[model samples]
Target chain A: MSGVFTEEQEELRRYARQWLDENAPLEAVRKIAETPEGFDAAQWSELGSLGWLGIAVGEAYGGSGFGFMELAVLAEEMGRTLYPSPFLSTVVLGTWLVERLGTDDQKAEILPAVVRGDHRLAVAAGRAAVHDLVARRQGTDWVVSGRARFVLDGHTAHTLIVEAAADDGTRLFLVDGDAGGLERNPLSVMDLTRPQAEVTATDVVASPLGDGRAGDAVDHALDRAVAALAMEQVGGAQACLDMSVEYAKVRHQFGRPIGSFQAIKHMCADMLVGVESARSAAYHLASVIDHDPEEAAIAAPVAKSFCSEAYEKAAGDTIQIHGGIGFTWEHDAHLYLKRAKSSALLFGDPRYHRAVLASRLGIE
Target chain B: MQVVVCVKQIPDPSGTYTLDPETHFLVRPDEQVLDDTDRYGVEMGLQIAQAHGGSVTLVSMGPKGSMQGIRQALAMGADRAVVVDDADLKGSDALTTAQVLAAAIQRTGFDLVITGTESTDGYSGVVPQMLAELLDVPALTYATEVEARDGKVTINRQTSAGYDVVEASLPAVVSVTAGVVEPRYPTFKGIMDAKKKEVEELTASDLGVDTSLRQRVTAVEPAPEREAGVKIEDDGEAHLKVVELLQQKKVI
Candidate 1:
């Protein structure tokens, strides 16, 4: 029977699952999460060497030259493992923005480094409908001033792509991480696997990403990022369901396994429905985004909204199913719960995306 | 060096299995995957080919439409594959399998042959040796580590106590053990490129091999279900009860 994914994609999924199971198990994730950087440089380089860091990058830029579908598979696997890395910030947001809007010279210089895992990138843009940073033309340069909150991996990125309001329209500017007038404070985030930061730019000298307005390009990149994040949510929801089912089968109470109970069985069954539905939505969005940009505009918000709620409900139900053990700090359930909550709020929460979807469908 | 790795497509070990009552053979599931043990041999072959400036080829003998597992191994960087698929091969013994594989290997022209010590489902553990004997080459079994240089193959053969360093000339068969070397995951490029790689399919008649079975299963029986063990709840004198039970079963 034919499936939504290709055989090659399925093989990629298996390969990724096996690699993550060995290299980034829960123990390694916990160790990396506890570190201040919240990422392991060695592991990041290893991922680059394995060609995972460049799955979606063009071959001209020293990447694998595959499309976003392969990236979705990698993202799902990363989410399943709770892999502690700046992949979203660096690969999804930063590199995409540059590749979408950067000049040929910029792409030639920066993308190779990003693919090699030698340089990291972050986008200093707040939530949708919000533009905090402002840029003004200076002598042969642009000076940016504003505070952008919830900047994913902002503190450790080698370069920062700051979305700022210009005199004519909104624009994207590239600033060095250690620019003289820039300050980044890492936030104490709920999701330990993904780090966020507050970036304050006080007249940081920057270079314009492209010669003109960047609103459309930024929106396209955001749509792609939302689709990618939805795929991750699907993986997280599936993992929560798997953990619940496995636990229910082994944990006995009152001389019978909890899974044998109708109530527990129903809960597990509901989780399965949510996870599979979310997976369908996410996979559909990934394909549309690769093939048709017009279809992707509508599919992105639908997937984002559905997957966010699915993951949130699955994570919450996972905790309830496990009873007291799931509540403890030692267990891995809370980690996923935190990830679910944080990821739902990352690009935009379910409510926000639902509104976006309604407007896109001309219902609002 | 032209390294050839013998791979098998077996039903997923995670799936439930049953024996066909009348035929006394395994009712193989629709889902099949590359045997876990053979992955080591493929990885070893790839490493040898990479270091010695050659390409690795995969050879397998199984029912038709079992190419999914072969495709998986190809995605792991094998240059090409040859599959011996024919209906007549059903219930073929290990020796018959070796004969068919030897023909395919000869057609592919291999300087060295690598295989897993045993297939997971059958556990015959004799196909590599049989192939070696049929092809008139020295067999090196249970290799934990293998090296090819100077027109010879050297291996650290695994044993119950320790490993033995064994060496043989070119055109040898070596069976590698699990954990010999970590298998590399297929990269996206590798997966995409595998689609265009060559997969030559042949039948038993084309290979000039007889499909008659030398060994066959006469009867099949399900293993007896395990009985529940006696449970002794913890009490103040639970240790004494446990000791008494152990003494009743055997002397403490």
Candidate 2:
């Protein structure tokens, strides 16, 4: 049997596609890029109205009562259209952590707003792209003074979910974005489509989430997040290859379509191979994230590593295929390149993920 | 609020069709495809159903291959599909096709029906009105904006003069125009799920409609090939070239 999605997933795909076609087409994407904030407020509000931003949130909290796979489908479409939103942060990380680890009151209060797209949240796990859950708690008012850089959508997020030490126990804290002791500044990054930021926390107003019990849940969610991000990266990389192939076909040189040449054809073919392989890995990872985290953890790195390089190679070759035109500022090829690089680094880059996989597999 | 969209899966008109120059007519030796306008119709149906909380059943009158377009509709959020397929009904024109579909609508019993104003291939822009006449229900054509409230349907129709706001009673047939909304790309998951959505197969006999029609393809002629002629050098030259081309064509 082929690796086709199940019947329910197909239904979700239909709904997602319909929504995206109307709400986020190429022209909508252009409009977003032209905006100063790079976000279409009306579009985001519409997505909220459709219950898309909260696909994974529980029904009690104003979501569509779907699973992570549904959210993963939305993420894939978002990646395809290069939709700029803090979906991964607020929906995936913030809501996941709060729902699984926060106090019941917190869940009741915060989860609903997160689902409504009214509350945008970010996470600060500290300097490293990848880190083990480690925290040191202070007194009753836990002061989490650490550094978390390159946080996705961190610059504009309303709240920061910080990983801090609580009595030598790993803990999650809800740190106020505008807290007096905390500082966050946007970073100059390659991916202009989605901004990244470096955050510094001092003795900030912190509320411990599930105290020490949140560690295991946070770790589990992180694994799923990694897998989800890897899947999105694969989608983005696949799109980059597709755009390049499409461009190569129409562009003419020496009285023939450039795609007719063996060199460009070979490049496209190779990119296809990489994309297909990465897709298999990414889809398999998404398929297993709920049931088999260990396997998903292993597959996540493989997909990310392969896709990270595949996209970079494909993006560079796309520029090469278009020659001077692809290199120009007006062209959109470079935007994909930036996104590919940024997505590769998020949730651990190819190298970092590979190393984690090596340890998990006992490879060395 | 049940909204029925009548969509026809015609060949894509935007692209060049396969042809046998020797015979001098369009040759569809391969598979036939649906028009883009019909896709927007399907999308609009889905949108109305989603907003109004009702069902959308996609109905079509064509061969078995046209089931693909119905399935595409199902994937886009239609509750089900009803395809009226028949061998003797092969050469039915727009009027006969609409009659058969109207019969299907009579059987299905929908609150509202939707369709493209015109298929890209046939460019008839007549099916919705034909269906409305057959069904004896009020109709709205070329609807760009539609709202249903208190069993009344209000529509904004695109007209040569401007947009006309038209309202009708509970049950109606609507024909959508081009550029209404973007048709969705079928996701991998949707394709898998659409297989399970009930796609009831119907025929002309099933609808109890006669297949006989006066319209037939007597002698096909290739549409005149459009030529690319004008080449404007720069901004100033573009204006001059435009005037020159218009003068040559006697348009200005």
Candidate 3:
């Protein structure tokens, strides 16, 4: 009951597909991606109002109180359409932590407002890819000072969950994005769909996460985040397959449709295989997150590895199948390719995750 | 303000179908899904019920696999669902479907009945009218927009010449097109809570109806394939050859 999604989940996926088809079409995505804030504010607030922001959140805090699979279904739809938003950064990382690790007071203060779209949040796992931030114990107070790069949605997020190395161990600190001496500079990215920023915290005092179990909490959060990102990859990969298949059907070359060619047909078939495999892997991770976190140590990385590579290959093949028209800037082919590349590098790429999987299996 | 939305179970055509040329019967894998065309009607029903503090009930008729379509609607916050399944009901025509549906609606009282203009599979566009006749109510077809006030419902029905506004008394049947209203995604909480929602199952006999095939499909054949076309090698004479072929085929 907890892990498997019922018929309701199917309806939810259909609803999301329709919503994104109407509200977040490719043109809307293109227009929104050009902005620094990233994503349409109206859609963001609309999602919050629709209770999407709280899909996995508990009912007591204005959430739908569902498991991770519901959220994965939605993220897949959004990724399929390339809906540009900071959903993962704010919802999975910030809102989830506030629920999982924040104090009762903090949960009462933050989760409700986040669910209502009154606040935007971003989380930084120090040195995830690039980290220079340092936490120093000045008397009894903790100050975070240094630069954290590749902070997802950091440019517009009003709240921050900054991880830093303290005197004892690495800990998480909640800091206001607009705090004195905190500077957020947006980064130039190949994928404008998901914006990243370089954050500089200069002697900023902040509150420690509840009970200072930051290590365990951060580990759990990262595992879930990896799995969530894999779901997004599956969505993007499936979209590429759809675009390629549609193109192959109508695109004519020699004497008939290019789909009649054996080479093109095999490419499309290979894409189908990739898309199906990745979907299975990502959903398996969702189940692990819900019912078996212990299995996630192995499942999350395996999913991320398989799905990220599949998405990249699928997007690459989409461009290849579209030929000259796909190479142009005027086409949507390149945009999805860029997103596939960007997401592949995020959290950890296929190589890194494969290493994690192999190490966990004691193969090395 | 009780509303009943008719949903049809369609076998996803993407699945492989087993062809039986002997009996002209095609056995399709039972990956039954709610007809995409009916989603708008269901959304409208749920929306109206939410605004009016009433209940939305879904009705479907198919094989036992029709439960999949029923559960899909129930998951979308429908108060309840009723599925009528009978082997004898197989191959029943649109009017026969109306008889079965009207009987189910009688047990589950409703002020309004809704359906898609046509099922995705059949596309006959006559079930709603047949149901209206069976229930003795106004039949509003091809509604692109709908609104209710007092005891009357107004529909902006689509026609070849733009749209026509039609108002009918309460307890009328409406067949809406695909894009009437944006459907809502079922929330996770709603999906979980759907377990508690009642899905009453009945049969043609229980509805006091004789289920027998009225219309018979005699044959099933794939469409004829097109002939291969001429191919011109991409040299200097390719343009002249293309023009000659086009002239020969009378394409231009």
Give a tens-digit lDDT track for model 3, residues B1-252: 999999988876555556556655445346687777877888999988888878999988887573656666777788888889888887788888999999998889889899999886777789999999999999998999998757899999997658999999989999899899987666556656777899888999999987877787788778689989767788888998888887777775
TM-score of each: 0.91, 0.83, 0.82
lDDT of each: 0.88, 0.74, 0.84
Model number with the top TM-score = 1
Tell me which of candidates 1 and 3 scores higher on TM-score. 1
Decide which is better by DockQ, 1 or 3: 1
Candidate 3 C-alpha lDDT tens digits along A128-228: 43676778877887889998889999989988888887778788788888888899999999899989999998999877777555757777788888878
RMSD values, in order shown: 4.5, 4.7, 6.7
Off by over 4 Å in 2: A1-4, A7-38, A126-139, B1-3, B9-57, B64-81, B110-112, B137-140, B144-157, B163-172, B178-200, B219-222, B228-252
Give the DockQ of candidate 2. 0.23
Please write out the lDDT profile of model 1 over residues A1-364, one tens digit for every residue. Answer: 2287787888889888988898989989999998988899998998888888888899999998888888898899888878889888889878888887899998998899999989999887646323389999888789999888888888899998888988887888899999998998888988889888888989999998876367677777888888889989998898999999999999999999999999999999999999999998998999988779889999988999999999999999999999999999999999999999998988888898899989989999
Cα error, residue B83 of model 3, in Å, equals 2.0
CAPRI level of candidate 1? medium
Best by lDDT: 1
Quick one: ranking by DockQ, best first?
1, 3, 2
Error of 2 at A59 (Å): 3.0
Ten contiguous residues minimizing lDDT sum, candidate 1 chain B: B23-32
Q: Let me know the TM-score candidate 2 reaches against the reference structure.
A: 0.83
Which stretches of candidate 3 lie above 4 Å from their native place? A1-15, A25-27, A127-129, A135-143, A165-169, A203-205, A211-213, A241-285, A290-294, A302-306, A350-364, B13-29, B64-66, B141-145, B156-168, B212-252
Model 1 TM-score (2 dp): 0.91
